[model samples]
Target: MSTLVSKVLVGSAMAVVSLFASIDINNASADELMTLNGIGKGKAEAIVAYRKNHCFKNANDLSSVKGIGSKIVEKNRKEITVGECKK
Candidate 1:
């Protein structure tokens, strides 16, 4: 039982780590962006729109979007990255 619990905990941790590692802000779709902390449909759409005209260099760049603030960016900082914009 203890060994099973350990495996479950490790599996959950790896899932979380992989999820964070894959959320690239520069190229994520609205649906994908919505997975971040505090992001909803509207904010995700706004992110997509803002991204269309601008390039994100870092997670902090998300604070420039109309509805997104520094707090939101900070919440997802470890879960976000700035990858090449999908063209």
Candidate 2:
């Protein structure tokens, strides 16, 4: 491939990566939650379940979930977003 084409592809990939790097806790599905740094199937499911009854106001609220903790929230800080949830 030509240099220009390669650069364009790389830029597009980076943009996509950055776009998904931040996840909205208020609306993320179980699979989306799994993309977090320390989140797994179980944790992701728990987050969804918890979200059903509670609206997380911030990334720190994730720690309140059964299997989640402050460490996980801290690690995924940059990846978590709080919006459209309860104030």
Candidate 3:
């Protein structure tokens, strides 16, 4: 491959990575939530379940979930959001 093509491929990959780096916990699916540090399938599902009864106003609200705590929230704060997800 040419140098330009290689650079374009690398740039595209980086863009995709950055796009998924921060996810909206309120709107994210279990898979998306799993992208956060220390969050697995069970915790992701818990987040979804908690959001069903209570909407998150901010990243800190994640602590209200059964398995989530302040430490988890703080650890993934930069990678989490409370924005509405685009359908």
Candidate 4:
């Protein structure tokens, strides 16, 4: 039972690591963007549009948009990426 619990904990940690590592906004679709916390369809559209118009150089650029705030950024930080360089 102890071994099983250890395995479960390790697996959970790996899953979380992968989630943070794979948040490539360049390839994310509208539906995927919406999955981020505090993101709705409109905010998702703004994200995509911003990427198209100016190209994202870093995650901090997201805060420049009209509706995004620090709270939203913190909430969605794990599910978003910028400067992907291949949109």
Candidate 5:
């Protein structure tokens, strides 16, 4: 039973790590965006919307969103990628 529990825990952690490994804001879908901490469906949609309307110059551009402050950006920076598209 303990081994089963440990395996489950490790599997869950690995899944989360893999999820994070593939989260690139430049290309993430709404579902993927929602997986990020502090980002709900609305914010995820907003991010997609923002990406459509304007280019993300860098991680800093996330701050332009009404609710995405620097702290949030800082926390999720590793999960995001601005790509070569920038100001």
Candidate 6:
């Protein structure tokens, strides 16, 4: 690719990454959870459902949700949290 094109691509990737905010698993809405890499509508809903019954103490606790494994948790660890969501 041309230098300009490459730069644009890299910049776009960085912009996308920057859009992801830290999410609180215990109180995040499905839409909020969907912002994470690897979490789609289904997984996001599952997270909300799981949270209804269990509280996530840390990022690793995300693995308790069906379909959410350690890999998904690890991938989103930097953007996941267990505290209350900021309004």
User: What TM-score, over all chains together, does every model reach?
Assistant: 0.75, 0.78, 0.78, 0.64, 0.71, 0.73
Taking the tens digit of each residue's C-alpha lDDT, what string does model 4 give over 1-87? 699999999999998875565455666777777777787999888877877766656666677777988788787776677745664
Candidate 6 structure quality by residue, lDDT tens digits, 1-87: 899999999999998876876888888889989989999999999988887777788898889899999999988888887896333
Candidate 6 lDDT for residue 62: 88
Q: Predictions ranked by lDDT, top down?
A: 1, 2, 3, 6, 5, 4
Best by TM-score: 2
For residues 21-41, write the lDDT of model 5, one tens digit per residue.
746676678988887779898
Q: State the TM-score for model 2.
A: 0.78
Tens digit of lDDT per residue, candidate 2, span 1-87? 999999999999998887667799999889888888888999999888898899998889999999888999898898898879743
lDDT at position 17, candidate 6: 74
lDDT per residue for candidate 1 within 10-31, as digits (tens), equals 9999998767665888888899
- The 10-residue segment of model 6 with minimum total lDDT is 78-87
Error of 2 at 54 (Å): 0.5
Task: Please give the TM-score that candidate 3 achieves against the real structure.
Answer: 0.78
lDDT of each: 0.89, 0.88, 0.87, 0.74, 0.80, 0.86
Give the candidate order by descending TM-score.
2, 3, 1, 6, 5, 4
Q: Which stretches of model 1 miss by more than 4 angstroms?
A: 1-21
| Model 5's TM-score against the true structure | 0.71
lDDT of 3 by residue, 17-55 (tens): 876688888799899899888899999999888877788
- Candidate 3 lDDT at 52 equals 74
Error of 2 at 86 (Å): 8.4
**CA lDDT for candidate 5:** 0.80
Cα displacement (Å) at residue 11, model 5: 5.0
